[model samples]
Target: MSKVAIVGVVGRTNAGKSTLVNRLVGEKVSIVSPVEQTTRNTVRGIVADPRGQLVLLDTPGLHKAVGTLGTLLNRMARRSAAGTDITCVVFDASQEPQLEDVGWMQRVAKEAPDRVVFVLNKCDAKPFFSSMFREAWKEASTTPQPSPVKPVWVDCCALTDDGAKGVMDALFDFAQEGEPLFPEDVVTDYPRKLAIADTVREKFLSKLHQELPHELGVRVKEIAEGNGRWAVAVDVLVNRPSQKPIVIGRSAQTIKGARKAAEKELSEVFGVKVSLELWVKVEPNWMKNPKILEEMGYMGAVI
Candidate 1:
């Protein structure tokens, strides 16, 4: 029988979790950005391998909570770890273990999942602290538990296919014999609207850089579909009026550029001619608004 497993890909923010998931799925199922908290939702990336199928849940990276949204993302990450066949905790081993990294290790040690894979990502970076991560894990495992948790350790770069192959192998090895969770041709089950929103947000993140990443939010209001084409209406949320001009840019250049780039990527991703209508709205403290949060799909189920 072919093996199948649901793997929870969790880690601290910017630990290369999204990159690794995309690499493993062999497609861009999740949006990637160098900005922290780039992934605001739990995206499911399905991998159809010859050995079987791996349902990878790419969750929001754990981060220091700042507002309602930040707390929700952290909760989503921790919750995603439960009820999975395998817990895949990715770490940016290029740097020494941080507090969040140790927090994950401690949780794993205490829970003692049946199968765990600790990925030491960014192995290509200089001063790779693989030994330091190992020591941290050792210290974390000291937490009292019913039994010892022995995790499969894999060094991965995540930026290249060759570097990510070990992660795929390790996940498959722990997979049990079962039928595939999704069809072979299907790579991801991420909602279409959310995918579009993520794509748009990613483009904006690239343009804005550190300007207002944490405060910016994108919500797809509607999608008008016709003959092989889609006209999507999106609301770009900013905390203050001052931030609105920054996102819209001088003479609307920034929003236009981000829109065109998002359209191009969405067209390719959905195999349709995609167009975007972006409306930049200053929704003072939108992150803390429960109604806006639900509308943005942040309050929805994991998958």
Candidate 2:
């Protein structure tokens, strides 16, 4: 039996956590977008190799919890680090590491001092954000450590596939020796319902403006599988009425575009013809509403 490995990928919002996972798995198990806080849940991507199997926990970026959802996401990221054999602390080489980044890493490492690896991502740094990260890393290197796990630097570019294999090798080195964590054919454990919902939400973020993207949430209201096609219905939840127009766009173009893109992607994910039904709902302050949050699959939203 191959050794089992749980590698936790951690970093700030928009630091390419999902992209890196896609690279290792060689498939798009996790959604990737330019928007920050794009991921609000812990997604698992399983990568199988000849020697062993690597089970990766691609978590929401470590950040301050603004409301119910943010708090839960932050908790999820921290909790993801607690029991994992390798805690990969990812950062974008494009931007300087802020105090928040260094501070979060320190605290997480306090929980598992020996397992943290500092991953400086986006090494294909487009000039504007290139030089700034060195200063950031210098700051991190000097930041007082609460425990013995000093952050180790590893650079990678998910889009270009640069230095990514190194990151995988490093993760393997840190993983515990045991049997393969999952069967070879299984790439991710996300339930079809939740995965489709997340896919819809991901498309929303990718296509919508920054300010409005975070205000949106998606839920799969119903799904039915037919002979040659799967029928799926999803509710697009927004916190306020004003944001609806932005998502819907002029003549509802934006909403229609988002739905088409989502349907295409979800079809590929399920490997069949997909009939997607989309509806918009105004869930006043849903981000702060416990019931709504729980219904959205954020069971830990109250943390």
lDDT of each: 0.94, 0.77
Candidate 1 lDDT at 76 equals 95
| Candidate 1, 60-149: lDDT as tens digits | 999999999999999999999999999999999988999999999999998889999999999999999999999888878875644389
Tens digits of per-residue lDDT, candidate 2, 44-115, equal 899987768888888888766788788888888878866777778778767776665766655654555567
All candidates' TM-scores?
0.98, 0.91
Q: Cα lDDT of model 1 overall? A: 0.94
In model 1, the clashing pairs are: none
> Which segments of model 1 are wrong by more than 4 Å?
144-147
Which stretches of candidate 2 lie above 4 Å from their native place?
Answer: 126-146, 300-303
Task: Give residue 2's error in model 1 in angstroms.
Answer: 0.7
